[model samples]
Target chain A: MFKTVIRRAGKCAAVAAAGLMMMSAQAAEPIKIGSFLSVTGPASFLGDPELKTLEMYVEKINEEGGVLGRQLELIHYDDVGNASSARNFASRLIRSDQVDIIVGGSTTGATMAAVPLIEQAEVPFISLAGAVVITNPVKKWVFKTPQTDRMAAERILTDMKDRGITKFGLISGTGGFGSSGRTQTLEVAEAMGMEVVADVTYSGSDTDMTAQLTNIRNTSGVEAVLNFGFGQGPAIVTRNYAQLGMELPFYQSHGVASDSFLELAGSSAEGLRLPASPLLVPDSLPNDDPQKEVVQNYKAEYEARWDSKVSTFGAYAYDGLMLAVRAMEEAGSTDPEAVRNALENIQGYVGVTGVFNMSPEDHNGLDPDSFRILEVQNGEWKLID
Target chain B: MLAEFLQYLFTGITIGATYALIALGFTLIYNASHVINFAQGEFLMIGGMATVSLTAMGVPMILAVVLAVILAGILGVALQRFAIAPAKQADVVTLIIITIGASIFIRGIAQVVWGKEYHVMQNFSTDQPIEVFGAVLNSQSLWVLGIGAILVVGLVLFFTKTLIGKAILATSMNKEAARLVGIRTQMVLMLAFMVSALLGSVAGIVVAPITFTSYDIGIILGLKGFVAAAIGGLGSGVGAVVGGLSLGIVEAMAAGYISSDYKDAVAFSMILLVLFFMPRGLFGAKVVERV
Candidate 1:
């Protein structure tokens, strides 16, 4: 009888323990990840795919048992490409939503607008914009994915130097990306002891760039030409360059590195080289390259899921989201300070854009070599090491 | 040196032809109702975008062009009947403001339907550029200039020879007087809009290969065309052609000779100088108020 009573007591203890464990699991709250992106307005092309990638990956993680044994709840707002609105949304995310982390900022204006707030809140932010200013000075809690325009300039100039072309003509658009790239190119050129023999600019809306290009063509000792512009402007410049039949080598910035640019430029794009992400030539990457599989898989998955072409801009978001998840995993908790510290110390994380190795001193740990120099060969992108 | 000058000139003339076509559309509407149609640029955008999408859908290029133009014509009639005719008693300024609203609304709808990517249209002729005196000219430029000349000649003949054309001219002169004489002023107004839409779309299609096309392509082009029309004295066909050509050539010259930075500034300054001397524009009608 005493033996039976002891066994019954053990069974009761087991039932009570199971009930307590269930109660504790129910008490645990979900981890919140906040985002503010330009999902509409002028920057929709950058934000649309970013939002898609985040949503898809968040769902995938949840399905595979979310980070830290808790589901991730994404709180997002559309800034519509406005800086003021982005600030408002960032404030709301920190104060009202009480999110643990942020992994978005589709434009430099939006990103910079939210920096002070995120820093004060001690929250980790991984921006997707491609300007050197975001991470160059190195905020404690901030990191970025895309290689900056400065890095693109460095890569192009290095390649030019390798080819024994020291003097080049520079033509840029007056838009934000183009103008910033022009400044960075000028600075990089000066540092490298190169000569900018001719410099000119065209407005965003100007359809004909032949006049400006003609001026470039006439410049004495202009051994090469670099067009640091984005959108259809570079394509027009490419066509005009061919129309003039100038034999000088041509280089375009990363802004116009896409398949759409290829279509817009057509045969005129042949033999023109540009600094770009390996995403543009995923299949051409050799088997031994680390970025080869990451980029190819990203391109394939993004194309399959979105039913559209994968852009370099979208790759920025992929890297940002992945980096955030990685930092969270390393932290082992949703604590803001821990996540921020983890993000700063992240090393050798393979991503669609590049292999990231973040440090406190280098918030954006990408070298100029991350931008692959690609050439248009027979209407296809050919990888050049 | 000569080659550089020729190159800039070719670029100027090609772009000028497009502006002149768009300005001519503005002239037709301004003459008919004394209201400048701000939706004129939307007509151009519709032409280029529709043709591009149609061709992408496997339609033949020539047929796509025709269908796109027809669609724009219908839209023009809808704008007159639905948007304008209901506010018949509104003043000319109010009507012009309505055109502005109509353009924004049209652009919004286009943005939804097409999204926001620029599209390429193949040249109507060979991709090869013709070289003259070491300056290259795109083969598509010929098609633009050729079609522009034909339309200009056709517009002249229609305004002079046809009875319906005379009716339109009469309505433009005095709407009440034409209505009293059984000219059907509303019908004339609708016809004017349709013809102008057709003209604008043709210009858009021909220039698509040169400038590329997008949902928002009309904004800048429309503004430039309006400048051309204003400089040409608003209602004179000859003036529009001259204004557009001069504006384009001056812009090219400024970019080539002075600086590309000052290209637009120079163009705007030219307008200021012209208006300072001749307030009614180079060919504005002399005052002969009926009163």
Candidate 2:
């Protein structure tokens, strides 16, 4: 009888110890950060560096004692630049991974593809895409880091207005980014009450845009020309523009704002203006600029870590992650609702892309002025006032 | 107004000349074997990319061009000997599919080696635009035109004047009869592939200045070349040239006068219309069915 009593007490003690362990496990559960990016395929240019930045910073954050004393577990999926696959991966991240927060979508199409599901799930999602449509309606759960195409159009038009040029010719590519940029530019132009003398478009695969540029040049009242295109198309247009010898001021969208574009277009890119991230002119930025230090440090760290030149596409990821961390910290927990609220209320958060001042109505809190207009001079980027 | 017309004409002709070069390559191979080489574009890509990378590695431009062309030629020979030759008993459609597979494999390898970024080659002669009657022409366009003409003339002479060229022509005419007459059909086929590859690479190199060189640069250009070849009557040299120039001119005129948005649509529609009327292309051989 005494032995049986001792066995019962021992069983009770074991249950208590197991219960204590469960409590500790619950207290220290990892904060799962889910992501779906176009890590391969055509959009790999955007997702490659983004994945690298995320991986590098996730490790760095863990070493620095992860957010809110819980380790960050990154559950990532490569969507291969397909929107349907992106949607599938995002669904997997939310349903199977059961993540605390999500941070990805390397393209506007991928981001917009997954937005409705994210909204329904009510999870905090910080997107790295640049389409204005992503955050325009301001879904409660979704926020974006990259400046929208609308802002690019606004900045370009504002700069043109400053130069006293109201009439211009517009040529754009028929691709997704190009078409969106074209629409936004037209809307912005209409809003500003400026006249677009000639508007033409070419396919992405077009080898010669000379005929299209000639149509623009022949338009009578055109004082300047604006090109909204991506990839080799814009570079080809730049070359064609120079060949046509139209002395009108040439402006490009942010799509071709990279060193490679300059190399492709060569001397033809000279005097062409575009809106670009300050990261392109890191050292050229004034010391007093708010983003100067942040831009330089991110560029240095990314280049050192990856051994590749930093791209503005990757910078979107950096800002997205930092914003996510900031939101979680501000909320003091990884609770989805608290984080979403915090992310929405984020104000004056200086990031590499721009100083973000997010509010409930403005999930992408970047101002149009955040984009600095840059001019290509002597085969290099020169910041324009 | 005439200047505008000239501008469109120059643009059309320059691009047309490139398409003609590509079409000639397609015509050469189709003449030898009924199989259409889908990997023809890959040879062009190889030529342009090799030259760009070689020049980047500090090799002299002339030497780089020579080496790049030679490399493409070797690739062409290897493709014939290894990929196409292995499936000797395969039907023409199967052989065409094999070429498609081979092209994908080549593209994948190139993407890994060169990375996915466009590279520019300096113009052969000058960067300045040649102004005539207020219409500007790219100096590189002149090189493209001149080189295209030279290649076409050389091909014509090679077929008519040379013994090996005559052997290739004989093989194209009748494989069994050519073999009965002591011509080695396999060797002729390899020669055809090599010569076609050479033509493709030369076209690639000249146009690299106008359209920046990249690993996948050949896909659209190659397809367009094939279209030009088809329009000209797949196996006829003169047809390829006429078809290419007309295709280019129509595209330029459509993009200029009509709608740039429907330029490709218009071009494709033109092809549909042509094939609907002339089932055999413009310059197609008048072959009587044996059966």
Candidate 3:
């Protein structure tokens, strides 16, 4: 009876050892990607679309046989658009979850707050927000998909100049994104030999922009208006501009090219010039381009799923996830260092926005050349040559 | 130059009129409960959104506006009864924090319910521009300004001449004494909240056509309304109207002359400066407190 009991115990021990080995193999297996987004809050307009894009890319990659023969898993947390919340989530993603890579933050404030934590963890971090300062005080592991304020300002100024706008009225919000964009645009305007005739400012929440518009209208030699704000600022400006009967050419920051802008601005948004990626103007791009194909598919899928068209915020996040997948494949492993090296050395990778050529120095991977000038024609964005 | 300046003044005054309406709402609640209803802006949001949604659902414009106001008034009463009455005897700071929490919760629920989209009510008149002194203004602005004036005058008459209105005034003056005199002071407080919400919703409905409405519009609107109320004197109705209009004009003028981006900063700075000099507010009556 003792010998029989010992044999049964030996069998049980062998099975337990095999189970431990299988669990260990499964634990260190999948490529885990982390996302911190503002799925609720003022910036949810951007974050919700971004989260959708991330999910879409993950599904697409998994269907294409996964990255490096291992499935990619996304672990997400809602930052609620606050800097402190973003920092906490970033730490958890790095320390507790032990994600292989982190991708996509909603805003510059949140992204900037998480940057130091990410650098300490030595993990790759890609941002979808457009603040120029994020890349300027460059961290080694940080890469971004959205064009910086500098690139956007340069593009806007060049386009405005082409449209015979010399003297301009500038209006911006006092927030970080607004102030940064305003400064960059002013610098670009001066560089392009354009004069800033009037400069006006408003807080992020001001409903009436009439006083500012009136001042701009009164400014001597003001031939055009350049608005540097996002969210409701542009809507207020557009409405006031129409009310003031100002017929000067109006240019908005790239931030104004969303469905919410049209809804808020109404008919006042007609004929406004803004520089945006081809993602929003998919119908205008050539059929042969790889980006065109992907954008077409994405639009169809997104519209079918959400009953809405994709925005620029959505496109950036979509491209960000695709870029991460490519890097993972090239690195041939989920190792953070290997992925960082692969991403930094990325060359001629065609994306929904443009062909990206990432280098050691430039993390954005795209420039003003990636943007196309678009005008709101009949309440829809139409490409301008 | 004179015409342009007059145009700016008219524009400023019109916007000031809207702010005054919002301030009246704040004053009503503050006078009755001695608690600032931070969710007052949410009343405006609800008013605007309710009207827009109703109009979209084939309700007549007048009916939609009336429904929106009534709905906001109900919400106000519910909020007071549930959130405020429970913490009525709590410290002033605690009451303030509770109201703020309620505001955030309402804002969150608004996003979930309304889906983060901006909505606009149709203008009372056609959206065509009306020329006034070399400046073009929408016909809706005139309606907003007119409605604000009428509401202020109506409120003035109600508080002075009506029995219920005078009861409310008596309650605001001395809650315990009024209760001792057979007045239901709690009912007066509920009435004040309802009236305040009704006023805020009316303002929102009028302005929705001009500015459009969104889920997040409440926070800034609430802050500005509070500032307007503070600038005037928290308990004075006439002061709220005057203060709100003044704040609007000042913000407009600052945007016109200095920089538009700093207009909000200028408005807040003016309020801070006012509070620094006149702790009792611009028109607040001096009161003696006995311990």
Candidate 4:
């Protein structure tokens, strides 16, 4: 009689323990994050690395039991570097997926195209583009990780002023990125007391920029050539400059920060200078700098994982994702409004790019100091002292 | 200012040479088929892309150029036999759409073949620029000008001197009448596509040293060539030459003097002005409608 009673009690206890485990598993739902980028088109150079970086981090975070003890789920779409496609995907992410937060848009044009819809949806958006207009007026729900075009211009001008380059010739592209860069550069140039001797523009598709170069060469008192464009434009200008045998100091924007620029420009890229994130040359950074550790860690991990060099574009996405995660953790909720509040209050969070101090007034949270002026010496980037 | 003017003039002329060659190709194909082969630009792209790939594989430059031209010719013949001939029963608008579809299809194939990044070849001779009258011109530009001149002269002679050319011309004028006269209209049409493709590839090979080639390069070049052909008179070879060179010079002047931002607008605006005045184009034969 005693043995039968003990066996029945043991069976009841085991069944109750199994029932309690099932209930806990049902209560913990995964956190969903949505993203759209130029993953397979012309701008894939930017978006491909960014996507890889996000995947790498999400995997690592999940391996550590995720944030708030929930797994992270990523939903992404390839925008194909077109505005209409970006807008369509952005709408779908908001209406259909109903993700808690959104991140990405590799190019300036793609990012701007998705901004209006994202604003209406009231979801926290952290863009990976470099355009200043993304957060100039400050959307409550929007934040960007990359340094703005205005900030890049400011950095370039500061370096130029330090080098005593007073007269400048600006050759810009007719595309949206080039035009925006032109405006910001001109604004910064005027403020720095620099003289604009020649202003020329070229179509992005033009095979020959010699006509524009010739005009600039003939302009008097031009001490340096500042090219504000991307892709083959900068390379074409570099080739033409060398062909013309002009020895003027050459300055390019951060758009041509990748090693592909080096391969395209060949030997002509030797002396060109541009402002870029320290992630590009982590070894040259001082040991005491706060960003040095983060940049090194990211570069080592990414190159090991993908067998490819990390780009500032990828670093931007990394910073944005980490920032969003931190904000969510601090808010202790995945609610969009709560995340937005936490993000704006974020301060001195050291990311791979720099220390980010976000606020209601500033959505980007990065200043001109975040960029380091770098020069190409013997086909590799060297930190400019 | 004088040197700048010369510089712009030289650049314009060099760009105009490529445009002229493309316009000539447009003329030949349009004459034979009465269908605009929008895929003409893809022939140029294939030529450049093929040459680049072959040369990268250690093939001699001369052999690469010849092989690329032949390959382009074969693609042209295939395009006619497959894409165009099958759509013979379609209306004019449908034919145009078919050609557009063919162009896009060729571009897609090229993207898969060569990848999306732009590729460039070294100059045919030396990279040294020759100075003339305060203006500098690269040696490759000379090659472009030389070949462009030779092709123009060669085509004119072929059309006037060769019996085969006359049969092709006869077929173009009236396909039914030419068929009654024992001329094979289908053969003539195929020959037209082959010749046009050959010319486009030559232009591509010669100009690749100056302008880098990518899959998307075909779209703009095709539009420009079509515009040049329209301005030159749709069916006139000499008019294509004149129209292309003039368009180039005018565009360069506008970019140098007015504004580079409005350069494309200036070129297209000139075309609009000409079309507004001459409904049949400068060199096009006047056609009267019978109601």
Best by lDDT: 2
True contacts kept of each: 0.79, 0.92, 0.73, 0.50
Kindly report the interface RMSD of candidate 1, rounded to 1 decimal: 0.8
Two-way DockQ contest, 1 vs 4, winner: 1
Give the whole-model CA lDDT for all candidates, comma-separated: 0.91, 0.93, 0.85, 0.88
Per-candidate DockQ vs. reference: 0.77, 0.86, 0.65, 0.51
Question: How much does each candidate deviate from the true structure in C-alpha RMSD?
Answer: 3.7, 3.5, 3.4, 3.0
- The candidates, ranked best first by lDDT, are 2, 1, 4, 3
Kindly list the per-residue Cα lDDT of model 2 for residues A187-296, writing each as its tens digit: 99999999888999999999999999999999899989999988899999999999998789999998887888988999998898999999999999998999999999
Could you list the iRMS of every candidate?
Answer: 0.8, 0.6, 1.8, 1.4
Model 3: per-residue Cα lDDT over A259-289, one tens digit each: 6788778888888888888877888986775
Per-residue CA lDDT of model 2 for B115-157, tens digit only, reads 9999999999989999999999999999999999999999999
Q: Tell me the spans in candidate 4 whose CA falls farther than 4 Å from its real position.
A: A1-24, A307-309, B288-291
TM-score of each: 0.95, 0.96, 0.92, 0.93
Task: Pull out the clashing pairs in model 1.
Answer: none
- In candidate 1, how many Å is residue B188 off? 0.9
Order of the predicted models by DockQ, top scorer first: 2, 1, 3, 4
